[model samples]
Target: MALTGKLEIDVEIKAPPDKFHDMFCNRPHHSQHACNDKIKGCDLHDGDWGTVGSVIFWSYVRDGKAKTLKEVVEAIDSEKNSITFRVLEGDVMKDFKSYVITIQASPKSGGEGSIVHWTMEYEKQHEGIAHPEDALQFAVEISKDIDSHLTQGN
Candidate 1:
């Protein structure tokens, strides 16, 4: 089996695409209010929000255990509504040699909803580590939570 792998998942959300993209680019910390069970909090470590090279720390739960991840904003494309985060330090580093996460929100044609695409690229330290299916599921769940929060006027 290959030690390096990539997972991509696309989910349909009821929220606006620009709003979803702005949340991650400008105010990721606010997601805690909507998906606190999965993502506890996000803190700015360096640089300013919505800028490349900014560092952010994330607290979350995985497999019923709390974990933390520190990452730097690697790239951002406003026209494409995408942001990429390169993992710097965290539990994932223990198992994976490298990890990158990219999220993109594309507005549906002539519709009020959006299709959110989440991609995870990683190289495992060894073959013993399983694929990050849980992480992908978590992202989809969080997207759904945010959609629900927005549609409910919360």
Candidate 2:
């Protein structure tokens, strides 16, 4: 079955989209704080931090055990302030046949603030499996957290 979902959250940022894009795309910076209380280690490989195509490895503690995920950049549009990525390898893959996530940031039309759209697409191993909303929610929450933290200083 094909699965798709999206989440939208408005966050005020002190800096413009350029700065916001840099911070959001920067994997190392994100790796550091990306961890929820359950997360353990996060790492990025290939080129520098946020360059397109770089791979990210994130390990987290769930149910008293460690699990990891590997994802790679699938597309990035700086002019449009959007980035799309897909899971190259990870625990989630065991259940899902395919998974992709995208984030778009656009300056609010005729306004000082900006809007962010997070999208997730996945296919499950079984026809009855649920769409990956929970995974998408994690990304949305962390992204909003970053946006909110940066906005407060502005």
Best TM-score goes to which candidate? 1
Q: What's model 1's lDDT at 56? A: 100
Each prediction's whole-model lDDT (CA): 0.93, 0.67
lDDT of 1 by residue, 1-154 (tens): 8999999999999888888988899989988888988899899999999999999999998889999999999999999999999999999999999999999999988888999999999999999999989888899999998888767853
lDDT for model 1 comes to 0.93
Off by over 4 Å in 1: none
Query: For model 2, what is the C-alpha lDDT against the true structure?
Result: 0.67
* Model 2 CA lDDT for position 25: 75
Provide TM-scores for the models.
Answer: 0.95, 0.76
For 5-116, candidate 2 gives per-residue lDDT tens digits of 4444454443467656766576434534634555566677665566777887878765566788888878888888888878878888887787787777778677776666
Best candidate, lDDT:
1
Each candidate structure's count of clashing pairs: 0, 0
